[model samples]
Target: MVKSNDSMKKNNILSKVLIGAAVIVGMIIFTIYQYNTAKAWSNRIYPGVKIENQDLSGKTKGEAKSIIEKKYKVGIIKKKLNIKTDARNYTLDFSKINPKYDIDGAINQAFNYGKDRNLLKKYQLIKLSSTKKFDLKLVYDDKPVNEFIDSIEKEVNKAPVDATLNISQGNIKVVPEKKGETLQKDKLKKELSSKINGEIDHDIDIKAPMQAVNAKITGDKISSINYKIGEFSTEYGSISSPERENNIVLATKSINGKILMPGDIFSFNDIVGERTAERGYEAAPIIVGDKVDSGLGGGICQVSSTLYNAVIRANIKSVERTHHSLPSHYVKLGMDATVDYGNLDYKFKNTLKYPIYIEGDASGGVVLFNVYSNNSLAGTVTELSSNVYQTVEPNIKYQDDATLPEGKTEVEKPFSTGYKVKVTKTTTQDGKLISRETITDDYYEPVEGIIKRGIKKPETTPVIPPAVPAATPPTPSAQPSTTPSAPKN
Candidate 1:
């Protein structure tokens, strides 16, 4: 029984040894197979490795990069992206953006697919790559793309246009406003990126995104001015100088066709700008420091005065107004509004609910201003009047003149009477008085009469006694009888 048991044990041990040797032989064969496979693919991509779905199997790093360049980089350079807009279509070439692929990175990844793993893991991955397919990442610079999009934006964007009014003679025309359009840059960029990164085998078409822009001043807002609310006219016939008349005409033209919305303040200085020779303003008569002198933009004050009266009649509020140092010849004593650039400005605000328009005309010795507004103010009437409260007599001034003969006199400047006056504005509707308000109390300075009297003495003529005959010797003896008889004293 013991020998039989030992025999069974010996046979079992021999069976175990044979099984262990077979296992060792199988491991050695598997290691040799793995090593051979890894060595074969040491410089080549795996069978299932791809870049953007383009198979790079069995290709070396240089060969893989060449394949990707021919398939993607070359194709990208030849491909174009069509951008559609409302106005037109723009085509952008991929070459402009200098498209590039990460050829090195993709090739390295494919080549190193199974290199970092153990024999079993490497075999499993090498086998799995056939069906699992490893894909490489794509990288490119987006700066050029952004620059192209910016150019597109500049070409597509438009500024909105506001409505305006044009008045000629008595006719009025309304120019309609126009809406604008802007490109949607962010949305367009995303769309382009998606398409550019997805494929490059064919030309692309992308619709540029856009948004609408609204105009600020619509036609309806400017059409509210349909009636003449107030008007005033001043005669420039007394101003004989052509330069002064030219200045008046230029200034009136500057103020013509001006529109003022509710609560808008109109600045005479801002509208007329600085009066200079470059602006076509001639030297004319202007009031400077209590003296009338020739200066640039001299006669524009008449236009300002005329417009001021019209504004007052329209019931508009004056924000800034100044009176001349001396009474103006065209307007009443207290009704003039004088403006000097950078120093004095005549400003008024539109107080009505609707917009107002100013129409000015200076022609044929007449300077006129017409204020137009809503038709609701048609029946309203405004009357302006000035009352003189005190009159100041001018003093006479004498000056010596050496050029004139003695007792001669010449008037340098004529005397002008000064007055303190009160200006009042009266408003009435349908012959019924609505309101009466005192506008201003102004005082005009008196101008002294300058008279030049002659201080030079007159030239005297020399008076000569009749030529006395040369004393001759007494006629002989007649003179010789000297010491005759002396008359009794």
Candidate 2:
């Protein structure tokens, strides 16, 4: 019985050893399979991985990126986004906005899908990757989109036109005002974003929203302005050159027939625009520092000065005004207003209860500015006067001239006396004083008289008298006794 038990024990030991060996072999096989599978997919995306419906199974990172680019990036560049506006239709290419996709990041994510998981989890993930999908985020520059919207806005937007009055002789002609329209940019941008950021398989179509804009000055609001409230004229024909006159006419016409509503500010620079040669402004005299220089749109300052006086006489509030370095001949010392584009501007606000119409004319040697309003204020009179408080004598400036002869002098520029003047404006109704206000206290710089004197000496030639011929004398021996000797005194 003991021998039989030993044999059974040995058999049991062998059975147990065989079972252990089989289990070890099975684990080795499983580990080898897992390692082989992992190595095969090391350089490629696992099977069944996709980016936005585009399958990337068994594809390398580079291959996946190419597929995504072909499907999305290239497609986006070829697609057109159509924008419909109330006025017209606009088409924009998606490439202009620089559309792009995160293909590289998506590919990396796909490649690393099952890399960080445990053995069992990795296996399960690899198995289920056929059903799993990833998204490639779309990106683009918004600046181009905003710029496109801005361009569309400019084309779709319309400015409201104010009613204008044209006065010829005594007849008045009225031009009706027109309402304007503006684009709804915010709403349009939101609508555009939804489509641009979505699937780009087809062309996009969007409708731009719009809103109506009412005119500020309607026809009826300006039709009652018929009476001339204030008028001022400056003589430019006598002092202006042909180019200067042209500038004055152009500037006057720019402000002609303009209407200013109550509380509205008039900007001379905004109305005249830039003084460029392309805008038909000619080279004329303009004040630069203390000297007069030739520049484009030179004589427009006279137009501004004339308009200033008219505005003051109409009781309009001056918002911005600057005096010239030297007193202008066209206007009084303290009454002149100078304007330089981008540097100085002449602005005024309408302070009356009704609209005021400015009628300007630079014809027949005169630049006249007329302010018209309701006839009820016709009896209201305003007078502007200037008083010189101090005077400054100009200094003489001598300049040498080599062209002129010695001791010769010539006056290049005449002396101009500077004055500190105070301007006052008095308002009266029916001979009763309403208000007397000081308009401005201005100081004009003294301009030195320039005299050019000759520093070069004159060239002179030496004069030589002609030599008289020596008299021919008779032979001394033959004529010695011919004449009697004279007594010595």
Candidate 3:
């Protein structure tokens, strides 16, 4: 019995020793595996990693980057981005923008997976990755992509038009506003870039991206210029000179039916353009240097002068003006505004709050100009007065004439007087004076006629002291005279 009991005890001790040895071996193997795994993951992507379903397990970052780039990277020079607008397909070349996938970033993300987690979490990640691979997210520069989308906007965009006011066929009218369209650039770029970078490769059907832009000046804004504000007229002989009348007609046509917005400048020269022979300007009589001369645009000054008076009455400010060298018969002395193509011009500004229009006409022996606006100065009466402040008399001179007979006198030109005049403008409303101002101080030159008289013979002849007659060939001789005349100083 004692021997059997000792045998059972020895058997039990052997079993315990074997169990401890097995536990120690298991621990050593586990330590070696953890060390190997940590070392392997230091420079390589985690197991079961993928980029767009392409596995990158057990590969270094560089190798994974190469693999992904080779599979997904496309030649930008050959790629094209398709844009569609109302059934029109536009192929935009990708070379200019230089689009490419960000392979390095995707690979780096895959390499870092399961590395920053705790031991247990790392195990869980690995376990999860076994069933479903971890996808490396893709990224790219959006600047070039966005700019490409912007380039398409020019071809597809249409700008809106504002309503306008003008005269048509001698009647005031309002032009309606026009609608416009634009491409949906911002929204299109987002969707297009996503499809291009997505893992699934396929052609995308892009619907036409369009939007509406409203006009700033609506129908209500067109009503501001509906009424006449102020006007004046001057008379002209229509039948005397056909070309002069034609010029007046042409200039009036150029100025008539025009709109001047608030604070806008009306340039007669700029609007009428150069008055050349090619522009249908005929050679007619015009004033230059105090004389009537033939020039390209003759009687257009009559139109301008008439418009000037109308502008003054309308209370519009003149920007630039120069009077004729001599007083004009068409308009008042201080009221005429003449324009020389390159040297001089006439301009006025629309000082009213609302826009104004010009109505000009020359017909039936009369030339007329009228300024119209919504803010009518109908009850305002405009009156003009002129006062001769200084008068200059003519000077007379005489000259000897060799061609005319002796003691015969002839007049070359008639005498003329010069005068300086002051022009004043007075405005009255409701029988009460509103404003009184001096408009202009003008001076006219005087010209005197020239007279020439002829000299027939000498007044007296000098005689020599009684001397013997010189011997000469035989001829009838007279007695010598001894009277000598005094010389005039």
Candidate 4:
């Protein structure tokens, strides 16, 4: 009985050991299969976008790497998404369909590829999701880049891809704008205000430049700009800018259509145009860039300067004026330049209620300014003599080494005679001269010099065969003339 029992136990132990070994082998094979499936799944890829135009979905992860590795290091394209692309729509249809690539067990692993690229920084594909939107923003130079961002957001939350009517400065014109098509004034103002910074909130520049002098001698108040005030147009054509001229007429306009009262200051430049030939002004000399230069309008200064002096002579306050670098020969040197343009100008207060008339004309090489005012005593002015001094001439100079050949350089400028003169301006209302002022002017010397140069000549010397002293005359005595030698004396 004991032996039998022992035999049964041995048998049982052997069976248990066999079963345990089988289980271990099965587990090992299953683990290996699982690992391979996972690896395959990781390699799987869905249709992915290329940087430029490469399709990523067709390639497995390893294939993705293999394809890019050989193409080009510099141009390796990766799929991505971002806010700036202005994407219309996109999607990965992996819901009902199986993954194109047979990578391991993960069903939709193909769609996750190229997630590490820089282009993906701004966006993420919702696992198995699709979307449509207005194009994403791809670039920005300033922050909160779009000025209308907030306003747009307020009106519509969703991206709006189709909308017209926004016009930039390039498309705007002076013509009347259409309703709904034109930018809203309030909105434009708001937009400009938002874009600009600082005390004066505005986007475009409103600053004007200094161009021509203004002249307003009429005694009546200017009531309108575009309105007809008496015979002349209150609303003149227009001046382009302070630096340039506008091809239009200039009118005496009121501020915001306000009329001027007696004793009120009339600003000329603020309402009228500057002097320019295109605007019907005769060609005259003018100061450009504050420099003395001859331009289309050569004689306008005489008019302005004349008016300046006339007003001063009448004991009136002067508003705007400019003096010449060199004194003028016409209309006395001390005063000049009075013009009637739409904007750039000069103005004075009409102190007297009684009207005054400004009369000026160009005759010969002269501009005469006369002010007609109602007064019991006619004011007259005479300019006294002012000190005059001679101008110094510039020293002559050689242009250059090339311009002047070596040893041939001469004075490029020349020394010459100089000159000076003084002009006295006289103002008269009726028969008497009430005021007088003298202006002195100087002119630098002028010259017409010439240049000359000298060149060295080669030396010439006689090359007589180096001197061989003339052979001493052959001794005549020794040879003997057939006559017997006389002896040794």
Against the true structure, candidate 2 reaches a TM-score of 0.67
Candidate of highest lDDT: 2
On residues 1-489, what C-alpha lDDT tens digit does candidate 1 reach at each position?
357988999999999999998999988997899888877777777777777778877888888888877787667678887899878898877777777766677667777877787777766666666633444444666787788789889998998987767776767788899999998898998898778766676788999999999987788998887778889999986765889898999999999878888889999999999999999999998999778889999899989999999999988879999999988878888999999999999999888999988888888889999999888898889998999999999998999999988899999987788899999988899899999998899988798899999989988999998886877785666546557888897
Misplaced by over 4 Å in model 1 are 1-32, 46-55, 67-83, 90-125, 130-178, 183-206, 219-225, 233-305, 320-330, 333-347, 360-368, 386-422, 441-489
What local distance difference test score does each model get? 0.85, 0.88, 0.74, 0.38
Give the TM-score of each candidate: 0.63, 0.67, 0.52, 0.30
Instruction: Write one digit per residue (lDDT tens) for candidate 3, span 149-230.
Output: 6767877788998666566564777888888899887688777856665553544456657999998666565466665555
**In candidate 4, residue 51 scores what lDDT?**
24
Clashes of 1: 0
* Candidate 1 clash pair list: none
Candidate 2 per-residue lDDT over residues 73-122, each given as its tens digit: 77878888888986689998888878888778778888788788777666
Candidate 2: residue 336 lDDT (0-100): 93
Off by over 4 Å in 4: 1-272, 276-278, 281-298, 313-317, 338-345, 351-353, 363-366, 379-384, 389-489
